[model samples]
Target chain A: GESVGLHLPTLSVQEGDNSIINCAYSNSASDYFIWYKQESGKGPQFIIDIRSNMDKRQGQRVTVLLNKTVKHLSLQIAATQPGDSAVYFCAESGPSGYSTLTFGKGTMLLVSP
Target chain B: EAGVAQSPRYKIIEKRQSVAFWCNPISGHATLYWYQQILGQGPKLLIQFQNNGVVDDSQLPKDRFSAERLKGVDSTLKIQPAKLEDSAVYLCASSLAWTQFYNEQFFGPGTRLTVL
Candidate 1:
């Protein structure tokens, strides 16, 4: 059984501060991990992704760190803004290409301006 | 390029009622997926389709849920005798290549279904 889960259900951060959201997975076979942001009524938008071969990957203002040894993943947002206030989710897909991603219970990131 | 398209934007029905959702993926995308997102929870994979064929549906509740992708482009998901727990948003997404390593998934405005 493959399942991805998150640590926090909600996080509040002051504007311009850094925020980190954590996740844990039960499947070691997962090879690819992705972070997504969902606003009030929008679909999950891709933020960044990291493969099992790497420990960290950086995107525009977001970073995804993967720890295969512990089966954990984390998403970091720098200089969090009001627009960044939303629910963030971490998803993982197994090594088999074209596999469905198992998503964790999302964490609501509230940025207080 | 346009993203995935889904409708109607909102649906409300009573328990044990039947409801259907439609999705049109991005042009030229080979893979399409359906997901169910309950309030305050992450999206769960319901089904995956590689073109008109099924790729993965292990998590889908086959007893009351059924989906089809005709002509390998657009798809429809139907639920029969829907339960109150079935109340959630149905999201549809598509990727250009199914086997590519870094293919980004483009999503649609999900159909929010409310079962009373």
Candidate 2:
């Protein structure tokens, strides 16, 4: 069975510090990966995504690094703020036409001011 | 553009009761998805629709769950004779189309269901 999982259950960081959340996926066929942020009582919001063809992708304040050799993925947030506190999920999808996403157990990111 | 829209922000029902949730995807989007998010976990895909047709429903509990997407627009998911373990958030998401490449899915504020 294919599974995606986070390395940490929770990560606490101080404001103005950097945060890195790690994930491990078991599916070698997974070509598309995405990161989502979910606040309390809200749906998951898309943050950043990277394709298997690319190793790194950067958004406004976030970066996603994918290591195919180890099947590891990481999300890095710069200058973490209280507003960035939420549960972060890493999802992977196969190379099918539908591309159904399989999400991992989330990592709670707590940024304290 | 408006994001995905869902109704009944919250619901409370007893075991064996039935509940239905509604969702309206973004305009012109051809793909819709339903997911269940348990506490402290990530969302799991339950069903997927493409233009009023069923693309995938392998994860959906067929004995207790049913969904329909009519006219290739709005969709509704129903759960009959629910169980306590069914209590979770039902999220609806939509994308422009079903593709092999990156097609970002926009999600709606999910409906929280509590089964007592």
Candidate 3:
């Protein structure tokens, strides 16, 4: 089933703490996985990506871990800030990188100062 | 560099009416895509194009939906006889290339469509 309503899983963390968001994918053949951050009234912004060959990739303040065996993915944000409050989505590319991306039910991350 | 662009930030229409949305990809991006985002959900790919050529549209409701990218730069998505379930945000995204290697996709501020 798809999440088409206003209710979504929410995670709240205090500023300066580490926040972790998790996602589970169905397609085992997906070639690429990406994490996106979407703020209120704004489009989703790319945070980081990891190829199937690699299990971990890191960016400035974000890290993405891929577990092909369990078909799971997770995003970690260090030193969370107020600006990090937003909805986070994990997307996986279909068979090929050129094809469609299957997104998961997003998790809302709220940071309080 | 400029990011993807879309127009008609918001729209409200009655069921059975028609509507269209436009998108302009970032410079030199050959892959353009349209996605539908329902409330609290991730974006769902509707159509994909590579330099004016259709690559994928499996999820598109062909009966009432149509799209085009004649010059391979800009594109449009149209829906006729809209249904209440058609209410969602239309998002446009582009990537430099859609090859074996994965490239980052840049998305535009979507057009929010409300069907009553």
For this target, which candidate reaches the highest DockQ against the unseen true structure?
3
Candidate 1 lDDT, A33-102, residue by residue in tens: 8898888778889888888899999988888888888888999999999999888888888776566788
Superposed Cα deviation of residue A94, candidate 3 (Å): 4.0
Give the residue spans of candidate 2 off by over 4 A: A1-8
Q: Across the candidates, what are chain A's individual TM-scores?
A: 0.90, 0.91, 0.93
Weakest 10 consecutive residues of candidate 3 chain B by summed lDDT: B97-106
What C-alpha lDDT do the candidate models reach, one value each? 0.87, 0.90, 0.91
Name the runs in model 1 displaced over 4 angstroms: A1-8, B100-102
DockQ, each predicted model: 0.42, 0.46, 0.62
The TM-scores, one per candidate, come to: 0.93, 0.95, 0.96
As a whole number from 0 to 100, the lDDT of residue A99 in candidate 1 is 63
Instruction: Give the range of the ten consecutive residues with the poorest summed lDDT in model 1 chain B.
Output: B97-106
Recovered share of real interface contacts in candidate 2: 0.62
Q: Residue-wise lDDT of candidate 1 within B1-116, one digit each (tens)?
A: 78889999889999999999999999999999999988777888899999899998998999999999989999999999899999988999999888847578888979999899
Q: Using TM-score, rank the candidates from best to worst.
A: 3, 2, 1
Q: iRMS values in order, in angstroms?
A: 5.3, 5.2, 2.8
Span of 10 residues, lowest total lDDT, candidate 1 chain A: A1-10
Q: Across residues A22-83, which tens digit of lDDT does each residue of candidate 3 receive?
A: 99998999999999998876788999999999999989989999999999999999999999
Q: Supply every candidate's count of residue pairs whose N, Cα or C atoms clash at under 3 angstroms.
A: 0, 0, 0
Q: Which RMSD values do the candidates have, in order?
A: 4.0, 3.9, 2.6
Q: Encode model 3's per-residue lDDT on B27-53: one tens digit a residue.
A: 999999999999989999999999999
